[model samples]
Target: MSESGSSNWAIEATDLYRRYGTLEVLKGVSIRLQRGKMVAIVGKSGSGKSTLLHILGTLDTPDTGTVSVCDVPILNLSSTALSSLRSKHLGFVFQFHHLLPEFTALENIAMPSLITGKSKREAFNRANDILGYLQLSDRASHKPNQLSGGEQQRVAIGRALMNEPDIILADEPSGNLDTETSIQVHQLLRRITTEMGKSLIIVTHNNDLAALSDEIYEMKDGMLFRSEG
Candidate 1:
């Protein structure tokens, strides 16, 4: 399957395992996510759901396994190569938003493109497009401290999308928002998947958000299993 070289599957993990000293977090787990679909992962706090997401996102390496994104085998890549691959193909959103407090929303969104060697003008233009898509064009000049929680997260989403990645890995993206804000963020995610044709792997405890996904998987005892439809 690896040599066949197809982009039909955005992410594929085979027999994944992870350990931190004596503690094993993932137990021979495997999952395949198709391109242009939203897959939600849900589980208890210590059920290794976040760990699996990290592995899939290439933020961490598995002790024994293989992860392929866009048909490229991640385990074989050097750290620098992996980082380059991630920047070019994957986007990430976390519960904390992780925006730089001193930078404007537009600057924050443009950082990734700039880091990838794009000129400041080119990055900011792309950032402006994403911010406009997220309906935050008016707030582009505002710093993180000046925006509300929902707006900050929207900026984070814009930052993640600024590079036009093939996949987005979001960990509890709306976890800090109020109920109404959460719903708005969920709707935005759905729109992105549907309109932008990007794949999404969201690790969320919110059942409402999970229900909007194309498929849902549950993590338990360090193993991932599909939920019954």
Candidate 2:
């Protein structure tokens, strides 16, 4: 791990660049996310919103630039170290719940912890706690197919929180829900940032949800700029 920087920022990425074959996707994209705040990244489809999120979450590598999560610079870490850092400090939620069809909500939520070597007893205890916190305690035994759209997304969010990560990176988290349900999920995400003290970065096209964030950025033509509040 690189030497730690300011603890105040949950993520700090600078001068990022990425390309596929000859297609340049990110052009000097940069962002700094403070702790306990919600940030919204909004743009048209294929504007590189998800690409930036992936780099921040350590799910993808930038062609050039630096990324630091919770003060530790990650660009130079070994794969094993990077994986550990990503698992311990970052959580991800996508447009789809991506829940395992065979697993109950509780089991799905516990999987992350279990993967990190937590015993089933310990993982399930934490999973149950998160389920209660998400107000989905009664749905713990339900498989993804058995839950409503909003419920499944809530379960996904619970799974994200199971590791007690410092930051949550959500890509179009409410994109698949109806407006009413989307608003609820948006509000729930905001609550998680405020109440659980987890910094959140969400990529969305929803203007209403963007308005609820502490900061908003617009991605256009592979560049990012802060939107006027």
RMSD of each: 2.3, 2.3
- For model 1, the stretches where C-alpha displacement exceeds 4 angstroms are 1-5
Q: After superposition, how far is residue 228 of candidate 1 from its true place, in Å?
A: 2.6
Pairs with backbone N, CA or C atoms under 3 Å apart (clashes), candidate 1: none
lDDT by residue (tens digit), candidate 2, 10-65: 99999999998899999999899999999999999988998899999999999999
Query: Per-residue lDDT for 196 in model 1?
Result: 89
Which residue pairs does candidate 2 place in steric collision? none
Global lDDT of each candidate: 0.91, 0.92
Backbone clashes (count) for model 2: 0
Q: Would you estimate the TM-scores of all the predictions? A: 0.96, 0.96
Tell me how candidate 2 scores on lDDT: 0.92
- Number of backbone-clashing residue pairs for each candidate, in the order shown: 0, 0
lDDT of 1 by residue, 116-166 (tens): 788999899989999899999999899999999999999999999988898
